[model samples]
Target: MRIAFIADPLPSFKIHKDSTYAMMVEAAKRGHDLYFML
Candidate 1:
């Protein structure tokens, strides 16, 4: 499946305890297509 994450700039993201980033990472690990729109 394809997933698009339209969020704040990934560079500026404070990933500590970030569920959204965690979810995206999990999806990527599962081989889903990932798109980021800053």
Candidate 2:
């Protein structure tokens, strides 16, 4: 599956605190392709 996330700059994410980042991590674990857009 392919997942796209429209989010802030990647470096700005706090992995422990950012929900979107967490979701991205989970998606990646499940083998989905992730794309980010500003």
Candidate 3:
């Protein structure tokens, strides 16, 4: 499956407790394609 993640624009960001990042992690584990709409 193909998945796209959109995130807010910021100078710096943290991955901890980030749902989008967590989703990407799970998606990768499931072998899904990832695209960031940054």
Candidate with best lDDT:
2
Each candidate's number of clashing pairs is 0, 0, 0
Report the lDDT tens digits of candidate 3 across residue range 1-38: 99987886534556786777778899999999988787
Model 1: how far is 30 from its true place, Å?
0.4
lDDT of 2 by residue, 1-38 (tens): 99999999999998889999999999999999999999
All candidates' TM-scores?
0.82, 0.91, 0.75
- Cα miss at 38, model 1 (Å)? 2.1
| RMSD list, candidates in order | 0.9, 0.6, 2.1
Please list all clashing residue pairs in model 1, or write none if there are none.
none
Ranking by lDDT: 2, 1, 3
Q: What is candidate 3's CA lDDT for residue 10?
A: 33
Per-residue lDDT, model 3, residue 5, is 76
C-alpha-based local distance difference test score of model 2: 0.95
Deviation of model 1 at 13, angstroms = 1.0
